[model samples]
Structure formats: structure tokens, C-alpha cells
Target: MGAVSAPPLFSRDFVDDPYPAYAWLREHAPVHKTRLPNGVEAYLVTRYDDVRSVLADPRLSKNAATSFPGWRPGRTGIPGEHRSGIAAHLLNLDPPDHTRLRRLVSKAFTPRRVADFEPRVIETADRLLDAFGPEPVDLIRAYAFPLPVIVICEMLGVPPEDQPIFHEWANGMADRSGPRGGVGRSVKRVRGYLKELIHKKRLTLPADPVNDDLLSALIRASDHGEHLTEDEAAAMAFILLFAGFETTVNLIGNGTLALLTHPEQLAKLQADAGLLDAAVEELLRFDGPVEFGTWRFTTEPITVGGAAIPAGEPVLAVLAAADRDPARFTDPDTLDLSRNEGGNLALGHGIHFCLGAPLARLEGRVAFERLFARFPDLALAVAPDELRWHSGLIMRGLHELPVRTSSPIRADYQAH
Candidate 1:
């Protein structure tokens, strides 16, 4: 029903619905040169197995700028020198550095660490829901955004009153990525904020050991000479704060939108709490938050879907397409809560796989479980079509989901 023959994979239309474009490329030109808005050559790799292979392949480094000379952010003449700093956040690091950096804080993200937050997550979620009032509420403002914003704020040891600042920084960072956006201001502000945080940590070493948080962990890592450079430490903290909130904000918002759109499955979920995890996974798969995975650059010429991928070109995998591939998933477009068949690129795969996956999942399950349970009568406060989606090649999420609850019964019940 679609173009089985290879077609131009770089059109704006393809960027919007890259699945069909990806399918075409997978069938025809797997590795083709295309120009970005900056006119640099990039390779778009679309096959599911191929994406996995490429991500795992050591030859394609994430730090493509150094490895490949011409790569540049769209129109941001922010010299390649500055690009590496922006890119060095864990996502861009490879090998010994990546391994070392990840090790420094991996313990903090463990099941034990995240699990300890369950009670707080539930409490915080319930409080946010309770504050919903009787009026139609924007879920993003009410809970979706605040919860993760709050979580990351807490994780980083940001002062109790300091969430709004971090939230603004996250928005600015996202905004800067926009075509005509100005991020210099945001970058400067966030860097200043993190520098202050580092200063605070240095001045006040923790008196108690177990009160350790992400900040303390990073501080400990840095003090041992295994210490990251000041810039590296600040960058990691910045990455944690933004990545933590932005991803979860989308997960909860996107998941809720999916449930609202598919009431039957949602109703099934409300009826049986046990399906919550799978339902979250299903939502993550059906209309997952991330549309594409991290960028990859080919170090050597390669062939995929039978087309030549020239060396030193960027290769992008349409993760959204991989999730919906009919070849791997039956009725790829349909949302079935009962089906246990599992496959998704939502958390990515291989070495660059999302380090915060467990925390995101735990937060998601908490958000949905408490959300539906609290607002049994929750229904869209505005027309479904009225909702707005944030524009991004990477994020998939609604700007707001206004839902209202009328049932007094929702409040009378307690899982606590």
C-alpha cells in the first residue's frame, strides 16, 4: 500500500511520518546521503534489527563531530568546539569514559535506590491529584510535569523551594533546540546554577552517610580522584535534571493521552490494577514518548537494507517506526492491554540505552496507578482534538491534557 521502492528519506513529510519513509528506506535505500537543514550529509537507517546492530556496533561513535569533520547542529554556527561540550552529556560519551562515568552514579539508579522513593512517589502523586480541585485540570500542569520535575529536583538535592527554576531551565534547554530558538541564555543560566550547586557541595560535605543523594554521590565520585572535572560534574548534574524530568513528563502525559484515546484498555486497567505495568509498557510501545533514538555516526562505509552508507555520515533510527513495525508486532497500530507480546524502542537499546529506564518506569507506574484510581470519573475536559503536541523530532507528548473528575467516590477510596 506504500512505496516499496526506495524514496527520498529527507523530506519534512518523512520527518513527520518517518515510519512509511523508514519502511521505504528499509526496503530500498537503507543507507543514503541526505542533507540536514545545515546541509551536512547524514544516513538514515530504519530496519529494526539493523538499528540494534548499528547501536551495538562500536564502529559508529556517538561523538560524531570529532570522528566525522562536517557534522553540525542545524544552522547553529556554534563551532564544533562548543558542540562537543553540549554533546558530551552521557549520551555522547563512548567506551572507557562512558563506562567510567556511568559507573560513578549507576549505583544511585539501582532498584534499591529508586525503590526507596516508592512511598514518596505515591504520596507526592496523591497530593498532586488531591489538589486537582473540581475544575477541569491540565494533567501536565497538575501532575505529569510537576511529579517528575519534583522527583528530579529532589534527586539532585535542589533546595525544597527550587523546582520552578529547574523547570524553567528544562524548558529553555528544550527551546534552544528549536530551529530559531535562543539557548545561549538558558545554557548560561543553568551552568551558573550548577556551578553554585557544586560550590555548595564543596563547602558543606555531608555529616551523615546515608542521607546521600545524586549530588552527594557525584560529590563522592569527584573527591576520590576518580573525580570528574568540574565541567563534567556540572554537565552530569545538568543532564540528570533535564533528562530526568523531560522524559518522564512525556511518559506520563503521553501515556495518559493514549489511555484516554483508548478507553476500553484504560477501563480494563482501572478494573485490574495488576495490568498497570504491562499497560505502561504497552503505552510506551503503542505511542511511546521518544520518536527517535540518539544519533549515530558511521566510522566506516556500511551497507544496510542493501544501500551503501558512506563513512562519516550520521545515521538516525526512527525508533517510533521500530516500535510500530508490523513485521515485529501484530496489528502494530492497535493498543491491546491483554497482549503480552513485548517489543519497543522506548528505552532504546544496547550501550546507549536509557540509563534512567528503571526510574522512569517506576514513576510511570506510580503516576498511572494513582491517577486512574483517584479520578475514576476522569474524562477529557476539552475536546480530544483540541490538545496540542510538543513539536520535536525526539519527543512525543501532548502539551496538556485537561481532564476533570466529578465523582465524590474517587476521594472516599484509599489505597494508603
Candidate 2:
């Protein structure tokens, strides 16, 4: 049979529900190559093993800025001053440098440290639920969003009181508009706020000690603790805010929604509480928080999947669909929490695996446990289809989730 010579395999219909498009590609165009609306050609890597190998391949460097010509301008979402601002982080760095920088910060995010943060994470989660009273509320606004914002704020040595401002900056940056446009207004606010916050922290550092948190550590890492460039400091702070808050927001929101829609499984979870960990893992795998892995641009003529994608192209791996590929699992579509932990690409794989994996998992499990325990009769206050998803681009999240608690008070309503 001849190769399918179609246009982009995915259209509006596909983005709306990419599974069928992914299934089609997996069966017929596994190594699909196509151009973007912006005139960029990309090699879309599907299939579990192929995706894994491609991400792990050293041949495909991470520093797309220089290797892939002119790749920088459009990709960052926020352009201009903040373009360079965001570009400085480790996400864009590859190999020895990526290794070094990640190693320095990696100590703070270790499993034991995450466990230590559990009390704080749970406290943040509980306080958020507390705000909703005993009434059903929009879970995103009440629980998922604020909980992470507070925890990340504290982690970075920023005051919890500034959460609203921090959230504005993150939403600005994540919205993918240019810094001068959608994000800049918020970036400006975050930059401005961080500048003042940084100034205060410098005069009187937190009581948690120099090794207490990520911000102080990064500040000290710079030349003699005096050479951290203003932009560098602001950028790291910005990166921490966005990375620390957004992923968990979606995981909790999407994971909760998945449970509500799949009542039998929800019932099972309520019954066995032990399945909480597995359920969170499966939610990550089954529907997963992220729709696609962060975009990667090819530097050289990289032949991936089955096609020879030319150099300087943008490749996006649809993590959500790839997780459900039959090639990798049995009954991939079903949200079976009992499935083995290995059945997921949710945290991603290889070196690019999320640096904040431990924290995200900790927040997720803790958030679910407290939410369910607080409002045992928690349920959807609106129709499932009526719930709006924060548009499909860089992130996937619910605009709101209203829930109702059957009782005004519970025996164990203590904030963690």
C-alpha cells in the first residue's frame, strides 16, 4: 500500500478529540510529517518505544535556540524582553549544562524532601478546601489552583500573601501571548513584585536558613551571591512559579473529573482508599494532565518514526494519545487505576522527565485524599459537558468544577 499523502492528519476535529487522529496515525501514519499553520515542518513521533527513544536520544539536542535556526521567536509564547527572560532556564539547556544546573537544584526536590513538604502541601490543600465552606464549589478556583500557588510560593521563599499576583504572572506567561501583549502585563507585575520581594528577602532572609528553599539556593549559586543578574533572578522566580503551580493544577482538576465521570471506579476508590496512589498514576497515564510533551525542534535531518523530517522543524509528541496506544497497553482507553505504574508517560520519560515529579505526585495524592475525606458526598454541580476546559494550547485545565457537600460538618475537618 502507498503511504497516506494527506494534509496534516489532525484538524480542529482532531485537537478536539485527538485519540482517533492518534489511532489513525498509529495505524497508518505513525511517523506523520506535516507543516504547521506557521509554516514549520515537524516529525510527530508516536508509538511508545519510538517516543521514548526519541526523547532519550542524545542526537536530538535540547538547546533548540541555536541548533534550530530562528526557532526561538515564535515558540516561547511570550516574546521580546521576556523572551530572553524565559529562555535562560534549564528547560532549554541540553547535556552537561542541563545536568549541572539540574543537579544543583535536584537536592531540594528529592523524595525525602517531598515527604517533608507533605505537611505543608496538605496544609495548603486543606486551607483551600476550607475556603469553599461546606458548600459545593468550583474546585479549580477553590482547591487545585490556590493550593499549589501557596506551596510553590513558600518553596521559593515568596510570601503566601502574594499568591494572587504570582498567579496573574503565571497565567500571563502560560497564555502564550507575547510579553508585550497577553503575558507582559502579568510578567511585568510578577517581575515588579519579585523585585520588591527579592529586595526584602535580601535584607532579611527567611528563618528557614540558607539551605531552606529553592530561591535562596539559586540566589547564592550565582557569582558570590552578588552576581545573580536582575533578569536571571526574576526569570528563575518566574520559572518556579509557572512550573510549580500549573502542572499540579491540571493533574488535580483532570484527575478529579475523571473520577467523577467514572463512578464505578470512583466508588471503588472510595471503598479502598489504598488505591489512591494507583488511581493518581492511572489518571496521569489514562488521560494525563499534559496533552503533549513540550515542543522540540529538530536541528538536523532527523528521521523519526518512519519519515525523514528535515532540520529546524518543530516536533510535538502527543503524550495524552500515546499513553492510550494499544501497542503499549491492553484496553488503553479505559481508566483502570489498578493498572501497573509503568503504564504511563504522564511524568514523561528520560532526562526531560519532570524535575518536579515528586512534588506533583505528593500534591496530587494529598489533594485527593483531603478533598474526598472532607466532602464524602462531593459531586459535580454542573453537567460534565457543560464544564469548560481552559482552551487547548500549552495547558489543559477546567475553568471551574462546582461540587456540593451533603453535610455541614464532618467528624474530621481538620486542615492538614
Candidate 3:
């Protein structure tokens, strides 16, 4: 018999529901080589242990400039000038540079700092829910998108009115089509805005008390002359603005959809509010925001799960796949909130573990708790087959979760 061909990596089928394909990869080709959406050849690590190992391996380089010299700055045709300023943030660095950048930003996003924002997050959730009347609404548009944007903006001291602009820029960056230099234009606009904001902050010094937002903290670090440069500071702000809200938005959106589909779990969660933390973790495990870890290039030839990946090749740790690997999790396909098997790579692992994890967790806990409490009868507005997933290679999120807040739970929930 002939060998079976590998499934298409970036097909519409893969996007709509990736778990099945992920399962196939884990069982057959744990270390699979595939073509990226942009037609670049890359290796994918799918098994749980292999994915974790690849993520923490120091031999793998995050800075594509050093490893993949021929590679250009942006995937969506972003301009060179605009790309470097934003791409030089913590996620794109390795070793000493990554360490230095992370340490400076870590201070502003410590667990305690994120804890202090809980009340504000809850308040924001309340306001969002209050604004959402008892009717069918696109939760992605009405709640999931705005709550995190507001929280992150307020923490960064960004003017509330400028949020729509950020949203526009983010949307453009996320577009996979690379539509006529749209990504480059968005990058330029956001970079320009951050530069101007930093300049204004530098010109003014508040007496008695300092600004507590992250941007001010970053600015102070740059001014102190010991840590960050002006360009680095701008890059840090750009990363925070871009990565900060995008993940949480998908988390809330995806988590809510999970609960709505699994009415029994939702009921269990609503009945026992104490399960909020565990429930959030399960939601993250079941379907997290980030589909894959950021770019990592093989500094040297490495064997992962019996597959040899050559040096200088880009590697992606498929988080969604690893989390759902049957070898790792019992009945991996099922979404059981009560399951206590930990070590899900939803937020990633190692030195590059998500800096905003604490914030995302806090937001997720609050969002799920309040959302369920507010509308116990929430459900999907359209048939499950009718819903569409985002086409982006890195993000696994529904384009819009049209949900009926007031409708009674459907009888055929499990069929989805």
C-alpha cells in the first residue's frame, strides 16, 4: 500500500476544527514538516513532551534575523522601518537581550500588580454586561474585544477614545491576506502613535505621585539611562498594545463558546462558583487563544520525536495540539472542567512564557464568572456549522461568536 499523504496544514478544514488533525499529527508525525501559509517550509512539534522541549530548548533561536538571515521583517508585507521598531520586543529576542527586556517589563506586570486590577476588571465586566441587553449579540464584538482593550488601555494610560484606532491597526496586522500593504500601513500608524505618546510623557513630570501605568514605568526606565533605549521603549509599548488585548479577547471569546457548547459544564460552573479557577484553566486547555508559539528557528540540527529538523529552519510549537494530545491527556477530545491534569501550554512555557498570563488569567476568571452569572441561559445564535474561524496561521479563534443571551439552552448542544 502507498503511504498516506499528510493533511493540508493551512486548509479551511484545519482552521474550522484543528483538534482532529492535531491528533493525527501527534500519532503519526509528531515532528512534522509543513509549508506555512506564506509558503515558507517549517517544522511543527505536536506531541506534548516534544512541544514542551522545543519551547524550553535554548538551542532554538527566537531572533529570526540571526538564524534566518534571508527572511524579511514582516509576514504581511509590513515595511522594514516599521517592522523592526515593533518586532524587537521581548517575544522576538533570545538570552541576555530577552532577559533584560523581560526583567524591565516584568516589574510592571507582576502578580500583585495584576491582582490590583481585579476590581477594575470586574467593574469593566459589569459595565460591558450592563451595556449588553438581553438579546442575541456578537459576544466577540460587544464584550470579548472591548473588556480587555479597556483594561490594557487604562493600564497603559492610553486615552479611552483612541481604542478604536488601536482596534483598526490590530485588525490590519492580524489580516493574513497582506492586503495591498495594509499591514505595513498599520504598523507605521501604531509605531508613530507610540513614539508620540512616549514623547509627550517625557515632556511632563507629575509631582507628588508618579503615573502608575505601564507606559510611564517603561518611560521612567528609559529616562533612568540604565535599562531601555527610546526605540526599545517604543517597541515594548507596541508589543504590549498588540499582544496584550489580542490574546485575552480570544480567551474570553473561545472560553465562552466552549461553555455555551457544553451546557452541562456551564451549569456545573454556575452551580459551584468556586470552580472558576479550575474552569478557566480547563477552558484554556480545551481551546486557548494562541494556536502556536511565536517563531523559533533551529540554531543547529535537532531531532525532535525521532524527526530530524535541519539547522536554520523555523519551528513552531503547536500549543493547541499539545494541550489536546491523547498521550498526555485522558480522553483529550472531551472538555471536562473538573479534570485536574495540569501543565497545559495554553500561555506557553519556559523563558518565553507569556508575560501577560497573570492578567489573562484574572480577566478570564472574571469574564467567565460574571458572564455566566449575568446570563445563565446563554447559547449559540447560529448553527455550529455556520460559525467561522479566523484564517490566521497563529491564532485559533472564531471570527465572531454570535450568541443569544436570552434564549433557553438548546437540546442538541453535544452534537456540535
Tens-place lDDT per residue, model 3, 149-201, is 78887887787788778767777755545676776778778888888887777
Question: What TM-score would every model get versus the actual structure?
Answer: 0.88, 0.87, 0.92
The true-versus-predicted C-alpha distance at residue 207 of model 1, in Å, is 4.0
Candidate closer to the true structure by lDDT (higher is better), 2 or 3: 3
| TM-score quality measure for candidate 2 | 0.87
Ranking by TM-score: 3, 1, 2
Cα lDDT for residue 155, model 2? Answer: 80
Q: What is the C-alpha lDDT of each candidate?
A: 0.73, 0.70, 0.81
Worst 10 residues of 1 by lDDT: 75-84
Clashing pairs in 2: 136-403
Q: Give per-residue CA lDDT, model 1, range 149-216, as digits (tens).
A: 78877877888767688777666665533545355556667767876887787567655566567776
Show where candidate 1 strays beyond 4 Å.
Answer: 1-41, 73-86, 175-184, 206-210, 222-225
Candidate 2 RMSD to the correct structure: 3.4
